[model samples]
Target chain A: MKKFINQADDFIPEMLAGIYLAHPDALRCVNDDPHCLARVGATPGKVAIVTGGGSGHLPLFLGYVGEGMLDGCAVGDVFQSPSPEQILAVTQAVDTGAGVLYLYGNYNGDIFNFDMAAEMAEMESDIRTRTVVAADDSAGAAPSGEGNASARRGVAGIFFVYKCAGAAAANGGCLDTVARVAQKAGDRVRTLGVALSPCIVPRIGKPGFQIGDDEMEIGMGIHGESGIRRGPTLPARQIADEMMSWLLADSPCQSGDEVAVLINGLGATPLEELYLMYRHVHHTLSQSGIRVFRVWVGEFATAMEMAGMSISLMPVDEELKALLAREANTPMFRQFSA
Target chain B: MKKFINQADDFIPEMLAGIYLAHPDALRCVNDDPHCLARVGATPGKVAIVTGGGSGHLPLFLGYVGEGMLDGCAVGDVFQSPSPEQILAVTQAVDTGAGVLYLYGNYNGDIFNFDMAAEMAEMESDIRTRTVVAADDSAGAAPSGEGNASARRGVAGIFFVYKCAGAAAANGGCLDTVARVAQKAGDRVRTLGVALSPCIVPRIGKPGFQIGDDEMEIGMGIHGESGIRRGPTLPARQIADEMMSWLLADSPCQSGDEVAVLINGLGATPLEELYLMYRHVHHTLSQSGIRVFRVWVGEFATAMEMAGMSISLMPVDEELKALLAREANTPMFRQFSA
Candidate 1:
């Protein structure tokens, strides 16, 4: 309930305005549709990568737009999908000779909105478009051997997808190639989150879910979806082992596999704790004979002020590793070399 | 406290170990002293910049040590100053004969410890050293013109000081010039914070400070120090106005002055909320006829999971602006251009 906001209804627009102010050189809003943010001076011939989702996840849908990253983003209110029209705005603004790519998480609302936008783009403007929905949250899907990985909900793993796909696009890859890389990221990556506390929406002024103070839920959704297992919070060593086991059980990373690691902090988790968890994650991966190509640990993605963390492991092929290492200059994320 | 830590006492060193693993390319630790971290191959002849403070205010003391920023940092336990020995270790590791600049906040413990380290370095190693303690927290200082600004505690404004001073050092500025610029940054910048809730240290397992559910404290310190006032929580707009007024009154930026602005989260504040607050901060700064040269909005310094934020305004001269605009590649901070 204690949030730094004015009128609750104005949260999304005000936040976008604030973002525009903070990262003026990196992003600009569409003329009539402020919800759409496009990179300043997007390359004329490069494929456009646009993403859209709820507003609460910082550095996700919009903050990803910049040089060597997404071409544009359509923003929505907190935990709410953007309108189809808003997604179309981004598509129209960033589209050049190359086709547009709609990249986003696999939530129901996002799926429907982005689908409509793709339809609208193809029908109205003759601008070819593709969709690469990320479903990397292993807990949201079925048992690894039985359930469809494409049906899982996306979490922090989507960032790696964005990195590779955006880099592919920036590298002047064909639309099909970009889509393929993105799809590959989706297939190779998996995430499992453990939550210690629920988050409050600025508008709602209350936590989205209720749980005991000493409890934690494994595989909790970003917006308070029920996690698979709930129990007393365990020590760092035990929790790190459990989460890593769940992730590897689903994706099954093995010896000598070149992989990228992300230890993502859910809003309130400290960087120090994230590193502590990463220490165990590093050990766990090393024990499995996984060779980490690159490691990122921070708040790459978040669920409002939720208190928890998510571990993401992306098995990296040579091509994927190259793309992941590509230059990225955004307000929140910046990588130097490809 | 429900924190992702194994044992409370193992927090600091374990966190540092995790950081070392996460960023092996950019940073390295002192072998004999794990408390000290230095940028790998810091420019040989460039003046070395070393910053340190208590732990917990992450991305502050250690995360800032990378290319084009601080050359090294001495880390301490949560809310406790680094020992003089630790500071001396970093100083000796990074000293390249251009002399060393010891930059840190003006907290009592940090001041005392860093002072001891500087003396030790001079007497033992014959390393020329200068100290530039940041006292930019307006809330912890005076009643505007009546009190000594140097008596204030350094809060988030210290980040701006670090950015400028470190950049100056990286740009081949002499030790005295770097120290002067740091001192100038410390003099011009001012910060005022508003806290809605208190934070609990994982080791303490209890709230450090207390307030009623609906109440708030203005100008609260990051370490739960007494603030200027306490009352019911106010809307973002009113709070922004009040904080801007206090900062401007203390430092008194002019109409045509170029300023660097930082909207720093105290912890547990979501990025959306931070941006929402920045909207008002931008408006207030714009209306004041002060043009923003650059703006940083995120958790630069935090007080565990405290639900609050601080606003820092640092007037920038031409030299300061150039230094602030210099490229910095750090773990948490990366700047592309001016």
Candidate 2:
């Protein structure tokens, strides 16, 4: 797998340099550390939102930093967690008198780092902070009541968490409310992905896993973690139907429920194919009497250049719908509405 | 080479079904022909802009149909031109009292079809029409003084033409003015692309072209058209510099000129890699003493799931800048400004 990179060690910094250069008007680094990136215009009195994780997932952690979204991000190298110091720096930089909320995925390293950063922020800056780790990958955990939900790996559904929590904060919610909103969204949204091909980490220089040419791994994690099963490649409709069924089985959505559908390309899948999956998902939802109120069909979260996609559904209520409709202006993602 | 598709013949219709299902509010079909997609709300007196070409390039022709962009699009099968009847239907559906403009890529099949469609519109519907073919792929033609510019392929730079022409039409420009703006934009923009891997057409189920594991092809077209040359892949910085220099040598841009840059992913390249390329592009532009006015880096136009990217530069005067900054609200693209 040939990559457009100079050196393995420079991948993250160079990518960060490129991001800062391309979006100077909207994003900035703290203390010249490219890993500690924050939005340019921070509202001082509003609660700040900060997210962090590995770097392979574009538009996930860093891309969410902007108006009506997150205020800062602590970026790590490909599939590696950021240092506690880096997280602390970002937290301190974005924190206002109103406090900061730490929102990120449910990864052990990220959890450990953010927890340490929160402690450091409290001790050193005297700032109050809250944490909400998204655990939305239905494949990684038992159904809602069967097992621990907090253990699931976060995936594309994390976008909803950011949107809901960010909207709450932008609407002048207190730190507790923002955290509560984030947690609520995280708990409600469910995602499951299928992998047609694996992706290579820049430093690794090879694919993390392999799939047969005529096979796909269903319910795979973004990092190429083992899925529920690997089987012969299926048609787009069948894939969507199976994924949607799994998601529905794990989620709280029932007849007459409304959902926000997100058909996210994992990395290398074409937008056309994602739309095909969306078509079938919509069909299944309508048959189940589930109404799709809003839809986002593109690469919202990606795993480098992996060839596959993930389907995420967030059953939305009046509050979630309003929050999801709120305006968010970021480099990779944007939404405009009430 | 696996694809997320059903029967090969159903590829286009299924994808169109997905698009229609997902965005019924913003787009609709003409006479129930899935190939003839148009914006739902057509301003009665506004000069309508219509574009069409082969399918597989999402957000190119169909994705541009909406407010402040294009009024309608005649979609086709993968890498195949739409029929003249399809184009005629779109033109008649979108054309109000104001005349319509035919804006599309400069391809042999497309030219023949659209020209036929224009003739039909004049003879049957009595709708006035003009044409502007985008020939912005600098790699496909000689520099300004050397050869006929109409022979070049229209790549991702067509986005600029759409923005300028669409803005002109939205701002109440007559058919002639919209056509003039489209022609002006088509003339000023230049693009060059590199392909790292071949893409498989759905019916073919095999790559149209192939490259070595560690090689890349520069100056490739969107539909597997042979590129200028193939060679071992270089670092991102070197690639950016080389591509930028080629564009500069062939373009009208000179020192102190302001330009908008678009670093577009072919399909499979990751966003992180695109930024690395963007970072070096900014450096190269700065070194050339050219001013960067605006930048858009993403998958604007794609070639299925081909792996690589392209860079586009458009020198802008006050007129072009204002037109480029105007608001556009399409399904895949939205610009809110000016």
Candidate 3:
């Protein structure tokens, strides 16, 4: 709950200014509105990619903007979506002569504002805009209701979409192509999370939710949404199996299905534990007839200092594999072009 | 104390197997040796860059091995150094006709063991090795004692050396040149840390240290070494000031000393707070006549779930600037070539 800020209202602006100052060569804020952070340059002919949501997930929306990733990001306060006007400004700023692509998480506020901004850019700026909403968090929606596609919330799996879409855009794909690739990546990905405790918002000065000292909630949302179940804290292997079962059920992966696995730590989870969880997750996936072609086990996306983790699986094809394998020269992600 | 491992002893080997299965193209482990992880078909004639440390810090020693960063990493148990024999095996495995450069942290165990391995390599294999220990933690050393040059302890600033040396070596710098560049980066850098709570090592099943609920310790080592002082928790801005003041005092910069600033979270600090800390740290640096040319704020090096952060500064010159800006295509770090 203890935070370092001059004023609660000025926190986002102050943070953006600092990010710009720190990464001047790699990032810049919109001329007046500090909330709109964008990669500097006229990315002409390339489908400009813009993603934004809350502010707590570093390297997610902002750290991902660079040569081969997002072109701009509109930031909100911690766990809050940017205003519609902020999104509009970022969309306009990043729109080169080529059309722009709006890629963001599927949080309610973000979905509403980004959609409004897309319409605004088309109407006023004569810039065509398309969108790809990342809906990878299976825990956000009822599994039997929509089959991983309906009303699903975006979580850490947004990073995979960014990489695939950015590579497509960088390869001179049109806005539609870039959007399609991102959408495909989003569709193929699914995530399930569990939380050991709730996070404290800096301004709120208290935990967002409560968990018993020896309890953990399975299939929890990033914002502490009620999970499918709560149980006594179990060993990490059992927890990994429990999460992997949900992800593997109804998965396109069968025996011999190639997939990418991401064992994401929700802020407070240590890397050591993440690797341990990854060990079990890999074992489970292998036993379930899936070959993990690529894996990223780290804190790609986070939920404050919440002590939990999520597992995301993305079925990969040759094109998806090639795009995923493309070189990305971002501050956070790097890959060599094969 | 709940962990994912079936047994504490199996943690490292199991994690290595999982990493190898996931990134077979990007990484591989030595035959029958789980401690040594190396890149597959790594380029020859380039100065082989090696880094290793405890297993808890993700993306530090292991996540950095790829095309343009470290060639190999020897991972030890949580917060412990790999044995000299493990270090020697990795060194030999990564050495491809070219001599190797050992770039590791400055912990006493690591230094002594790696030094012994370097000597063993000299006598056994025809491999010549140079060393560049990351001595960047300013708080660990007294200014008047051995000076920052000798007494500093390595922390997150090791990433900067990984970047510079990786670039230099990738650009065909000789072993000595790569070591010199890494050493220069190590020399110009300084870090200071603070912890709100001690991290609990999973295997140890207990907190590393104790602190009052409302108290924090500044200048704490990465492995929970006692800090310079412990006091009641203050706002993030004051904590940022305290950390920056000590770091800047150790390496007083002039008006135009371009530097790279890293606001590293010690595991449990949220990105929201880290960004807030970054805001204050940037402002403090500006007021101190230092200009930050590059900035990275993230959980680069963590100490389990310790609620703390460390700020690192590296003064940049033309050569250092070029090396810093050089393209590094690693799994965790990337920058445009200078």
Q: DockQ for candidate 3, please give it.
A: 0.53
TM-scores of the candidates, chain A only: 0.97, 0.97, 0.95
Residue range B1-338, candidate 3, lDDT tens digits: 64455676777777677666666677777857878888777676888998888887776788889766889998898889998888888889999777899998888899989999999988888789999888887776654335545567788889888888988888899988998999888877888888888877766778888889888888888888877888988867778877777777776455678888888888878776777788887788788777877778778888877888888888888887777777665555544564
Scoring model 1 with DockQ, what do you get? Answer: 0.80
Sorted on TM-score, best first, the list reads 2, 1, 3
C-alpha displacement of A296 in model 1, angstroms? 1.0
Clashing residue pairs in candidate 1 (N, C-alpha, C atoms within 3 angstroms): A325-A338
Which portions of model 1 miss their true places by more than 4 Å? A142-146, B144-146
> Which parts of model 2 are misplaced by more than 4 Å?
A142-146, B142-147
Off by over 4 Å in 3: A2-6, A140-148, B2-4, B143-151
Candidate 1 residue-wise lDDT, A139-247, digit = tens:
8664532267555887889999999999999899999999999999888999999999999887788889998999999989888888778999999999999888888
- Name the weakest run of 10 consecutive residues (lDDT summed) in model 2 chain B: B141-150
Each candidate's interface RMSD (Å, one decimal) is 0.9, 1.0, 2.5
